[model samples]
Structures are given as C-alpha cells and as structure tokens.
Target: MRVCPKSTSSPLDEFLHHYMNGHDATVFIRGSRTPAKGTPAWIGALLSDLMVPVPFPSHSFDDVIKDFSLTDVDFTLPNLFAEPGSPEADPKVSGTIHVVAALPKQLNFDINVTNIRASANVSYQSHKFGELHLKKWHAANSTKVHDDVTGESDLEIYSRIKSAPLTITDSDVFSEVIQEVLFGNGDIILDADATVDVKVTTALDLPGDSLGKSLEPQISELRIIESSSAAITLSAVVNITNPAPYSASIPYINIHLLKNGSVLGNTTLRNVNITRGRNLNIPVSAIWAPEDAGLDARKTGVDLISGYLSSYNTTITAKLHPKSIPACPIIGQSLSNISINATVPRLSAPRDGHSPDNGSKTGRGKGEFIRDATFHLFTSTATFTLVSPLQYDTITLRSVNATAFWNHTEPVGEINYDYSFDAPPGASTTPRLPVDWSVGSVGYNELLGAMGGKLKLDARANITVAIGAYEETLWYVGRGIGATVRL
Candidate 1:
C-alpha cells in the first residue's frame, strides 16, 4: 500500500504561522498602542492551545460461537495424554493447541478461529490503547528528542506550537533580533554641526589742564640805551601781543636796565593800561648821571677841548604788573585805555669862555670851554591796547558775532570780547597800560545789523607769563587766539 504525507495546511502549520506573525490569543485583537500582535511568536500560541492532549477515538470487542453440527464435529483435538490428571485436558488450558477435523467440522472451526482472531485484533488496535500503555509496550523510552517533534519539551517548539506572540518584556528574543537587524553590522551613525555669537565695546579718556597754567610767549624782543658824560639815561620798550581771543590785564610794566651785573636804572608803570586785540608797548626810562657840569680853569688852556666818553653794555628786563583790586568784585570789569612814554637827557658840552689878551695866566680858554652836561627829555613811547581782566570759571558756551575788519571801509564794529585772567599770589598793585585804541566809524549795532545782527563772547584767563628776573614783580603774557561760530 502507498502512504500519503500529511497536508502542509494542517492545524500545526497554521498555528506556527500565526505565532511567527505576532498574533495574540488573550488580547481582544483591537487596535492598541502596544506593539502589534501579529508577530510569529503570537501565532505559535494558538497552535499550542489547539494541540493540548484530548480524548481519542477507541473500540473494544467480545466474541462467542454457538454449538456446531456434524461439519463442526469433523475437527478433533488430539490430547497427547487423554488420561485424567495429565494437566493437558484441564479446562484452563495454558499450552499451544493442535487440532484435526472433517471438512464440515473444519469449516465450523475455521469460522470460530476467524471470529477469535478478529476479537484479539480489536484489543491490540492503536485507538483502543492509551498513550502511556503504547509508550511502555511498543516505543523505547528516550531522554532526547528532536525539538520540532517533542514540542512540549522544546522551548522553540513550544513557542511555535502555542502561537506565542512577541512581547517587549524581559525576554531578549525580540531585542536580539532587532539588534541584528538595526546594528548587526555596525552601530547607528549620526553627524551634526554647532554655532555661537559674541559682542564687545570700548571707551577712552584724554588729558586736561588742572592747575590753570597758560602758554608763554614763543618769542620776545627788548631794547636798552645809556650815556656816560650826561645824566645817565636808560630807556626800554616791551612789545607783547595777545595771541588768543581772550585779553590779558598786565597790572604793571617793570623795566630794569643793568650794566656790569648792576641795576643802572629801573622804572615801573604804577597804573598800566590794558591792551585789547593788539600788541602792547610799554616804555620806561630813568636818569642816573649828573644834571649839570662846570669847567675848571686850571685844567683848561688857551685852546682847550675837554670831553668825556664812556661805554657800557645794558640789559633790560620787563614784568607784568599785578592788580591790587580784589579779583572777586571786578572779575568781569572792563579795562581802561592806557599810553606809556618816557624821556631821557641828551648830553652836550658847555659853551666856551672868551680868551683874554696878552695870554694872561687867568685868561679864559680861546675855544668854547668844553664842559660836561646832562639833560632828560622825552625819547620814546610805548603803547598797549586794553581789554577787561576777567576770570573764566565756567566752560565757554556758544558764540556768534559779526566779522571784524581792518580799515574803515571794513565796517568792523562787532567786538565779541571774551577774556579771562587769574590773579597770581602776591601780585603787584599797578594796572595794565594800553598803547593803541581806535573806534570803528560805524556803531556796533549798525555793523551787527548789517551783517545779521548777532554777537557772542567766549573768553578765558590763564597764566601765560614767564618768570621775569625781578622777584619783586609779577609778569604775564598771552597765547592761543582764534574764532568760530555755531548755528
């Protein structure tokens, strides 16, 4: 007989497919946020549930034959010892039997044999025997079995057979599989870049004047003159100009002439004039020699010529006068115009006496009796243009003024005066001297109106003078001059 293989579409096969595809039996099979239930292991759980041991079909049989006729009596059983107590004739027979019978009896016997054979076969059938009995009698006891065959004992087999669904529990089966799929060859890779921003700032400081010291004159010129026979006259002139927009108040102009390291003559301007917007010249002169001279007859002869001549180098020094007036009261007071001049004597020989006749011993000199004489006269002039002496304690604000001009045709009357000066310690009482002054033909209003009618003054005072020779006096000069406008 030919035997056919079990169909591939069996219950076991379906269960295994369900488990491998992730199906779950316990769950309601609804949409869930959890991992899907249609995994291979879940399908295996279904197969296991169906495969549980269940009752199998079984059959039992009993047989009995009726009395037979002559045909049945044809058969005979030969008892090797037909005697009593031989043990072979006992009703409970345990030995093998051999019998001979007639045809009719053989037929009857054959029927009985067939019936008994059928009953015995029924008792030994596979469906009638329990699995435990079959295992004990026919199959050998085995400790090891193929995983697929012994599904109950094999983990893999059990999972597949029961259609066990895949779950993200402590089990590492899914984890191992996922690792192999995602990172089996290598670790997952990624790449990225970063960015940042920044900012900065800075400040600076500059130097400024703290003591209020001003700039001195870049250059200066001085002159001196003297005579020997006549009354010794010394004269000097100092020229100072304001190089700044502000004016300077020179309280005194001190002039000193020195010869052979000694003061030959000295003069001071007690009340000096203030100079504004121009150069200032202060002149000083003094006489030191004899004022008159007499002729000596003993030393004179009939023709006598007597004259004296002496030479000496002269040095002149100047000082800026200080103010006795308090600075706080007249801090912004206007300056007064001033002119300074000095004179010195021009020396000459005295007229000669008439000669006597006969050359008498007491006769006067024939030519003019040369006599030494000295005189003092006006010789030079010094001028200074004056401006107010004020202290600029505050910062200069904005300024606006008309343009200034030189000639009368310029119509320059707008004077934006902004001057300042600081009073030195222990300064002199003499005032400044003004050398020159002139007013514009047009008034300040007329000039300003004609040229937009605006004026401003931004003045400042500073210590511009240098240390003069005389310690008894104070002197100062001016520096830094300019003009600007703002709209």
Candidate 2:
C-alpha cells in the first residue's frame, strides 16, 4: 500500500534516511515498521515530498526564511566611541553579532560564511536617509543545538563586522527620523536594501532583507544645577527604552545643544547602560554657553532665559560636532550636519525658589527692585527699602548717585553715597543717604512746608552692583515712593 511509486524511494530518501540515522534517529524511532510516535512517519513523508523537486512547501519555506529574519542587533563600538576619558582616538570598529535562527533538523549543515561585504541603503517612508556599509564580516555557526522533541535546530551565529561606516546621505531625512523617534509612537520603521557578497561552504545564496524598527528613548527632568555669568550648568535623566533582549554599554557621549540654529551648549552622558525596558535615572549633564554661540550670543542667551522665566515653551536641538567625539574628528565632522530638536523641559520649581508674596508692593517680578522710601527733613537724609531678585546670591551696592523729585520734573533733593553695603536675599533697607536739598526750588519748599506729612517722591539713580566676581552698572527709577518728613 505504497502512497507513491516505488521509484520515489530515490537517492534523496536514502540520503535523508542515512543522515537522520547517523544522528541517532533510532532513539526517537526504533524502526520504520513501527515508528515510535510520528518521527519516522514524518521523515518518510518529508522524503516522499522531496521527490517532487520542491521538497519544502512554499508556505513552509517562507516561514523558515522568516525565522532567519534579524530581530535586533547589538554592537560594542570601539572604546573611543563608547567610552569617556579614553584618549581620543579613531580606532577601527571591531565587534561580534549573535543571530539565532531555528530551522528544521534536516537543514542543519556545517556552514561557514566568510568575507562578507555588504552595503545597505536605509530609508523611512520612501525617503532615503543614508547608506550603511558592512565593510567585512566573518560568520560561523559553531554553537548549534538540536532539539530532539521539536526536531528543530537552533543555530547560533557569531559574526564579526569591521569598519561598518554609516554614511548619512540626507540630513533632513535623518532629522525627521529623530523627530519621529522622539515624538511619535515608540517605534521607528526603517527599510534596508542591502547587497552582500560572501562565500559559504555549501555555496547557498540566502538573500536577507529586513525592515528594522527601534523604540525611542525617553528623556525628562531637566533642571539648572548651577549658574554664573560664564555658563549655566544643567542636569537631567534619560530612560533609554531598549526593546531587544540584549544590553549595550556606553562609557561616554558628548553632543552639542543648539537653539534657533545656533549652538547653545554641550551635553554629556557617561557610563550608561541600555537594557530591556526603561533604563531609568541615566544622569546627563549639559553646559550652556550662550555667550559663545554667535555674534549676538549674549542676546540669544538672554532671550532663552527670559523665555524660560516667562513660562514660554522652547526647543533645543542636539547635534554632533568636531568636539563631540574628539578622537574621531572626521566622524564627528560628518555627523555634525544632522540635528534633532526636542522641547526643553519646563522648570517646575520657581526661578527664585520662593512663593510669591501677593501682599508685598515690590519684588513682584524680576524687574522690581526698590520697595519704598522715607525722608527725614531735620537730618536731611533718606532711606530706601530694596528687594533683590536672587534667592541664594547677594548684591553689593558699591556706589549710588540719586535725585529725588516731588513732581516728575521738579528736583527736590539729591543723594550721593560712595560706601559699599551688602543687600542679602529678599528685603533689605539701604543706609540713610545724605541728601543735598535744593533750597530755592518749589519742590524743596513744598517738602520743607510738609513738616510731618508724607509725600510721594520719584527717585532716579545710577548704581553699581556686584555679584560674586561679576559687576555691572544699572540705572534704576523708583516712582511714587512714600517719603515721611520729620521735625
């Protein structure tokens, strides 16, 4: 009761039977006459099917090919690219790739792939972004395990690829890809078309193509840690959402931050580990150099600060520059052309780090300085209550020359103070400044006649103030300050 002609038991069946038997097929099936469970029957069917030239069904063959599809890749770039504090050097890339594929037991062979050189063009949404060059790779399936129960072989491939240069052909597309990763759903789909040349021991041609998708990393919690006239230092955390089963380690990464097409500062991440799920609390530091961005660097810097203080949303772009990878200047220079932008995190904490006092007449905003004033007619002196914007810093008043007016245009008296005094954070009263009365002026006569009354006076002053090692001269005007007359 043969299902097929006796001639179907040809060389292919003999070859498969011999191959399986050599690998202890008897352990699974004692004899073809009484095949234990279904192994021998399945083997016979597989052999009979092979007589039709296409031994594997089209769908089954497609499934097997899909099993070899690359799920993800892990790379250990040269130390110079991944580590910080290492001597800047542009060394060649040397790393191993582990690709695991499951195949039917009969397909298992001692295959060695050598001298593989491939170049792939990467595109997203029909737009070509770059070319990925696989300079050379050697692959060997030395670590393979056969599953007796499933009749499948798990082939573990170890491949080493070198000098795999990724050349960006379109920077705009690169930026769009980054934006998609940052703002879109966690995944980015990229189609890769590759042409490869390799010599396999069995001379089998396996054309491999894959649409790679990667999850976007999340960054949050940016805050100003330190500040000065020179630069502002910031700290943040990054949670790299790695979808793969493997992990990667980075020793250091430096990138430039840009604002409105101008370099704002440099950001650095050191000793980061990327693993499955969210890799949280990865520390990041950035140096904000508004003064060095462009010819109007200071203005740009001030605008950024002002925007932040005013609770306006702004964006900062990250880019690679020559100094991004000091040891690999050429690579850095090439990558510098590509940039990605993200919204700068809003500062949740108060800029002054204090609750606003609604009851206070002054210090309402950053611009408010003078609070109130008082005048002593007998002593011909006045004192002013001033508010400082700094929460932890202090201002030193070095010199002040001011004129008081009863009316906006009529000068009543003048104050000239040369001695320096420190005004700490919050509220402080200035020392009694000696006033030179204008005896003949109508404003002075009005002030003299109001012996025990309070008069609203306007004061304009040119003052010199210093914070730490920085000093600047500012002009201030106080309007409607209540001055109390005495004696």
Candidate 3:
C-alpha cells in the first residue's frame, strides 16, 4: 500500500485494511545496538497489506505511536466457511499485530540487528506446517536466524552498506510500522552487554598521500622515477579498507609526501567511500616538481643524486576526518591524526626507468654527478662555474667532472673542476668558465638532435653540488642533452 506521510501540523484523515491467513508482513526499525541481555525485537506497527493509502505524519525516528491495534489484520482462512457439505475447510484466520513497545531515544549497534533479522524468518507457520515441518524448520532456521525478541531496553540500528536505507523484514512479516526514519545520525549507542569496545577507524587522504600509509591505507609500492632534470614522477598503490560491518566515507583526504620533514609533494583525495568490510585499492600517479616542494630541486636535487643508496626519511602523513552522512547511522566516523613514517633510499637513476629502493651502497664517485643540468667543460681547470636547477638568486657550483661520449656509447676523456665563486644576486646566468676545451674537426653537428631544441653532450661526469640535507654530495651526471656542449 502507498503511504503518504505529510507534515504533522496538517495531519490528514486516514482509513485502513483486512488481513488473510498464511499471509506475511514486514516491520522495519531504525536504531542502535546495545547490551540488552533480554530477547530483541523490531518495535513497530503491523499494517495490513490490503490497507488503503495511509497518512503518516512526518516525525522523528523516535516518534512512535502508542496502543495502535490493527483489528482487521486478524488471521483469516477463506475456505473455512465456504461450501455446503464441502469436506475441505479454508478457515478464516485472524491475529492481532500490535505496536507494543516504544524504542529508546538512542540506538545501539552491539545487538547486531542484522543478526536479529535471521530469527524473524521463522516466527510463524501454518498448523500443518507447524506440526510436520515447524520443528525441523525452527531447528534448522532458528540455529541461523534471530528470534522475535521483545524487551524494553535501548537499541542501535545501522543503515545499509553506504547508509543507503534501513531495511527490515517485509509484509507477511511485520507490515506497516508506527515509527519514523529520519536522516541518519552516524553512530549507535549500545548499552547492552560487554560486546562493545569494537574497533572503529577514520582515514584522511592528503595531497601526495599514497597507499600503504599507516592510517589511511595499505599499499604495495611507492617509487620516484627520474626522467629529466625538469621532469620526475612518483607512483604509488593506495588501498583503503572499511573494516566495520556497515559502510563509511572519508569526506576529505590528502596524503602529503615529506622529505626530511619537509613537504615534497602531495596526493589529494576527496570524499572517499567504502562498502562494508571491503577495501578500495587505488593506483595513484602524480608528477614530481621541485617548486611544489618549496625548494629548487633542480639546484638542490643534485645532492639527492647518487649511485649508492643514501638514507632519507620518506614519511606519509594524512588527515582523516569524514563527516557522517547525517542520513546514516554513525559507526565509523571522522578519524584524525593519521601519520606514518618509513625510511627510503634516495637516488637518481637513468631516464629509461628505475625503482624506489635503497640499492646496495648507493653513492656516486668523484667522476659521477647527478644528471640534473648540463655543465660546459673547460679544457683547463683554471676557473670553472656550475649552475643549479632550483630557481634562486645566488647559486654555488662547488665541483664537477665532465666526459664526452660518441655513438651513445663511446666515452671521451673526462675532466674535473672545483670552484668557489658566487653569481651576483638576481643574476639569471652563472659566470662563464675561462677554461676552454679544444675539439678540432669533431664538429658540433653530431652533438645536437634535429627532433627538438635539445642539444646533446656525449659525456658523463661525477660532480659535487650542495643539495638536500647534505652540504656537498657526489652526483652522477650522465648523457645530458639540454644545452650546447662547449668542450
């Protein structure tokens, strides 16, 4: 039957219907779980399936009508008084479905109302069915389902998985209810037994946040891929899980990537929702920009370049606070202070590709410099100047080594230089090195590519630049093709 629940101030006149034998009905309750040692039941009104459109006034979930008895819903058997001299008997059946108890103001969750749903299935049966199969049915079904429990204690209720709807049994079971279901208020108050003390968690997804974070999720891998001095990428696997029996959501999430307690990058996730007892695995990919980290990594990124594994702390800190979808019960609500830390290896690998790992003894030698920017080599060590990638006013190039390559394989002789000169403040360019290299007849055409404005230097060098947490560190400078090669 269609139910029209208008505003309470304008309650409409209503009429109501008849019930038949062997018929079924459903009654739904919206509440919380609690430590009630007594039998549990869904407290509501039992309306007839054949009732006319009923007028239900809008009221709070706790708003329950009292002493309402559906008289026409008496057990009925049509054939009971049907034929003259007929051996068959379709007896009229009648029963009273009354709204007996008023639910407590607060709801509980410990009662596992869903578990109580099981018993509602086997509450009634026909006489023949009760005599022959009722015992077996009750024996089999009762073992698995919940019984119709009636007690005057507090109750807790949960909406569906995503707090979609609070569904109880259907017609034939309990019928029309004398209660209301309003926008849910997350969380139930269960004052039952000691079955509480359950674990509820909240997670936040911040910018640069990845999977495997302690508070937000678990992940398989998180790596930094070095492509060029100006281009880097970080990849991660993020998996969020909802361990509660009901569904939940993370209204806002941001996972920040920290480098030595400094903000490097971040991953932002908004309104993350998960199903009951399920997990959400997300493959996260983001670009790595030095400017995003508040420092000129191209300049200081050189310090992080190394062939040997250097230890730097890669931490995952998240802010997990999700609001309850006011329409659903609150079990797992906003969680805060989600922070995790893990030590990671910092190094720059070939542009082809690489992984995030603390490789065996990862450190660069004297001839190796991080391939962040191109350096011009002077044939003499009289005076040399080097530049960093970070956007800053003054840059200091401590030392560097350069070597030329041919055919992408053959390496020319290598050279080393050390200096302590500072470029004037606000100067965009570094001082040119007085030292020059003589490459007679090996023209500059082969050192450049026709595809783009990129120039190639067929040389590798191990240089030292001030970067990161270190003052001066060794970096491997490999086949860089950005600026002209002045050898």
What's every prediction's RMSD, in angstroms?
Answer: 58.1, 12.0, 24.4
Instruction: Give the C-alpha miss distance for residue 342 in model 3, angstroms.
Output: 5.0
- What's the lDDT for residue 66 in model 3? 27
Give candidate 1 misplaced runs (Cα > 4 Å). 1-238, 242-253, 274-283, 288-315, 318-487
1-487 per-residue lDDT for model 3 (tens digits): 3335653221111210100111222233333344245534332122222234433233243333222222222211112133422222111212222222233322221221221111112122220111101111111000111225754443232211111111222222211111100112333221111111111111111111110112245554555443344445656656654333333334433454544444445564444554544365666665544454555543343443343212232333332222212221111121222334533322222222221121213221211222222334433322222222222223345775665555455443345567744532221234444433334424233433322333444445565543222244455434433333444
TM-score of each: 0.14, 0.45, 0.28
lDDT, residue 419, candidate 2: 92
Q: lDDT tens string, model 1, 51-125?
A: 334322221111111111111001111132334333222111011111111121111111111101001111111
lDDT of model 1, residue 457: 17
Tell me the deviation in Å of residue 95 in model 1. Answer: 99
Best by TM-score: 2
TM-score between candidate 2 and the true structure: 0.45
Worst 10-residue lDDT window, candidate 2: 61-70
Deviation (Å) of 422 in candidate 2: 4.9
| Residue 321 lDDT, candidate 2, scale 0-100 | 76
In order, candidate lDDTs are 0.22, 0.59, 0.31
Ranking by lDDT: 2, 3, 1
TM-score-better candidate, 2 vs 3:
2
Clashes of each: 70, 0, 101
